[model samples]
Target chain A: MNLPPLVQGFVLHFGEMGSRWGLNRTLGQMYALLYVSPQPLNADEITEKLGISRSNVSMGLRELQAWRLVRLEHHPGDRREYFSAPQDVWAIFRTLAEERQRREIEPTLSMLRDALLETVETDEEKHAQARMGEMQALMEQLTTWFTEMNRLSPETLTRLMAMGSRVAKLLELKDRLRTRSG
Target chain B: MNLPPLVQGFVLHFGEMGSRWGLNRTLGQMYALLYVSPQPLNADEITEKLGISRSNVSMGLRELQAWRLVRLEHHPGDRREYFSAPQDVWAIFRTLAEERQRREIEPTLSMLRDALLETVETDEEKHAQARMGEMQALMEQLTTWFTEMNRLSPETLTRLMAMGSRVAKLLELKDRLRTRSG
Candidate 1:
């Protein structure tokens, strides 16, 4: 494995983080390796670097590509595919959020909406429907919000994440306005 | 089982999303039941509601407590322990993000730091160290960003996620300014 000591350390760290963010430890580690790699890495190279089974590397790469965390690079005169992460951090952020919304949030929202179509037979059912409606609306709003953000430039995402302390006050005021308007 | 149809739907849906969000399917469904419930539920109650084994509820509730996702509640003269999720969406978000950070990110960072302290003995080791440093730095920054976000009100989170369209641009500008200033 061509693992660098310091870089390898970070790669290991990301691998662990992968599980927390809806990925496995190996997936996290693989992305870390790709993220810092200046050159596009083929699956064989990645398998060699991490010293894991080639099949495991293949599965991990598929997951990363699904997350839009890795890109395939086709080099001339070689049938082997090389991979790399987005150099622009903002693009990575957009793709991650977009993919998550599609994969995780959208299906659940659809299910929630389907539940809404059912007839209520009792007070308990009525109450459940009310709560479901609230959550469904919230999901719809959140989904639309992400869709909008997916369209943003990296600069916007950074500024927004660092919106600083005013964020709290802004939220309170926004809620108040939402209440009044409602 | 006081299973309302819509609530049951929510329970089943959450069960499916559980693995995607770190929790397993049963845990997800169990939490969904707790979230919509007006009163605290004992393990038997949860088991009944979801048609699962009482023992499974016991284990699932234990995991929820560890994640800080479920709260322990008691009633006077009640011997059985009760569990429920925070009804406030923001509180739930805080627990999820914070618990994940502690479990996944912190340990990996520690590992990377230790590896970075080692002396490089070969060209390969040197490259590893360089990669580790970059990853460590990225995790640190991302961690800082999440830490800051954790402090925001749920309304702020909703608003921020709603501001998805602007986040990328905000991030891009932040990166440019950072480059200019650095």
Candidate 2:
């Protein structure tokens, strides 16, 4: 850990937070270093700064790349690959959400869909299917909304969220007007 | 594993997803069994149904209770405790989100706040602080929005999400009207 105290604080925190967010401590530390680095960092630099084994850093970088949380970079005439995180915070958030949805939520949803389609021969099976149905419906609603939200520009999404509860009020007004007109 | 094929499939899926979602395989299996069970299950019943050891069931149940994902119940004249997941899918989702927010997100946000306040002595520290600031601002926006959304009725939330990108159009219309009036 050769980082300045200020930068080290964040790297350490993310290292602790990594498992909670589906990455290990080393991956978290590696990603944090890349995120805060002013320039893209190569494997050797990451290994030296974090004081981890070269193989560990190499494996962690590969894992980060798999998650799409870190990007590989190349400098002209440099043989070693460099890595950096997406600089835009919004882009990072979107990427994380999409990746999790793909990896975790989508599998569960597909499994539920298949389970829901199965024929039931007993009350237990019927009950299980019904519960799965409810879970599937909710997931479908959320995933549909997320896909739609992904189409919006980050600025638009931010503005919409900034409205907070006010958006509910807008929906209510629209509902009341539609009722009267109908 | 004494479950019917229909229910067992879902349980196995959740068990696999457990580690990804911050719970271990046993905890996921326990919760899924409870979630789909028609009646509250006692420890022995869960142990037998899942064919796991008594101690593992005890530990998994305790872990679920701590996560607030399972509720404890008692039947008249029975000394043994029973457990069941909330029947409402929306409630389960809300509880899961809130728990993860408190355990995972809140700490990171607090750490970022403190890190952002620290004095910087070098260009590297300054750049790191700037990155932290960006991350903090985005997190604050998201947490605020999520907190507000949590206050809404599930039906309202479903409707709001169903509105999807349409909400962006509503915001755009509001902006245009304000510009015209101004």
Candidate 3:
């Protein structure tokens, strides 16, 4: 399978980054192909482009769909299912963040909570609980911030992002006003 | 090597999540052991506790040090090096986030930028460039926000996190006040 030089570069790079992002090489390559393609691609086309087997393509598509990173579509006259990445890159980023928080962060938070609830029979257990408590507090704070960010309209989110360090200035201003009024 | 049941549960959970977070099972287990241990542990103690070979422990410790998730210390009169996780969980979280952004996100952003710089000879290439542009913009915005957050003092970061959704309210308040006065 011969990919265009540009697409090939992206596909290969993503393949290498797959494991780092909690995905396999094939899934990363498949998502990269879909992202770069001008049009929705069918399973056979993806397999042909990536030089993978038909079943592998099917599995990869399923995984991508589960992550909500790809969408299923069909052309007017086509009976086969086709996949393409969301056009809005921000949407894709949010989806990835939410999924990772759910998969990785949430579980650890729960584990910490459970550990904290256990009775401390010794100083060692007390120390362990203290560590878990600190971790839990940090995770909870982060998750709360994430949830609030998720509530913002996309426009507002974009503006907030563009604000960047300006938020710090705003925060300082708020503190000054509060101090003066109080 | 036998671990306390509670510690074992936490260790196994982290070991399972290790690959998802770009670390291996051994690295996760070693970190978990260090995290829960009441005191710093030497390589020999870690090997005996985790039932891993000394060399495997060495490699995992090296990787953990590279991630900045583990610290080395020496007890008085003890020549063998000792390893422990940072007592400050937030500091550990920040280190992991910074390291991951440096290793994974920055490379992908650079790749996108390079792809966008190429001359487009075909409609497909043009479309690919458009997609890459969107991704690049999103990544740049995110990196900018991360950098700003990183610049914040730990106290300020904690306050901002604790503020959570209230920041949005503050933004709205500022907007309304400006509209009335300006």
In Å, what is the interface RMSD of model 1? 4.2
Give the lDDT ranking, best first.
2, 3, 1
For candidate 2, what is the lDDT? 0.93
- Please identify model 1 stretches exceeding 4 Å from their true place: A167-182, B1-4, B109-142, B149-182
Q: What does the TM-score come to for chain B in model 1?
A: 0.82
Q: Per-residue lDDT tens digits of candidate 1, residues A1-182?
A: 45755666677767767777888888988998888776789999989989898999999889888888999989999999999987765566567768878888889889888988998887767766776777787778767875775665555444555665445555565567579999
Backbone collision count in every prediction?
36, 0, 0
lDDT of 3 by residue, A23-110 (tens): 9999999999999899899999999999999999999999999999999988889899999999887789889999999998988888
> What does TM-score give for chain A of every model?
0.85, 0.96, 0.95
Give all candidates' CA lDDT scores: 0.77, 0.93, 0.88
> Residue A161 deviation, candidate 2, in Å?
1.1
What DockQ do you compute for every candidate structure?
0.38, 0.87, 0.68
Ranking according to TM-score, highest score first: 2, 3, 1
Candidate with the larger DockQ of 1 and 3: 3
User: CAPRI verdict on model 2?
Assistant: high
CA displacement after TM-score superposition, residue B20 of candidate 3 (Å)? 1.2
- Give the per-residue lDDT digits (tens) of candidate 3, residues B17-101: 8888889999988999899899999999999988989999999999999999999999999999999998887788889999999
Residue-level error in angstroms, candidate 2, position A36: 0.5
Per-model TM-score versus the true fold: 0.79, 0.97, 0.96
Better of 1 and 3 by lDDT: 3
Query: Candidate 3 chain A — worst ten consecutive residues by lDDT sum?
Result: A156-165
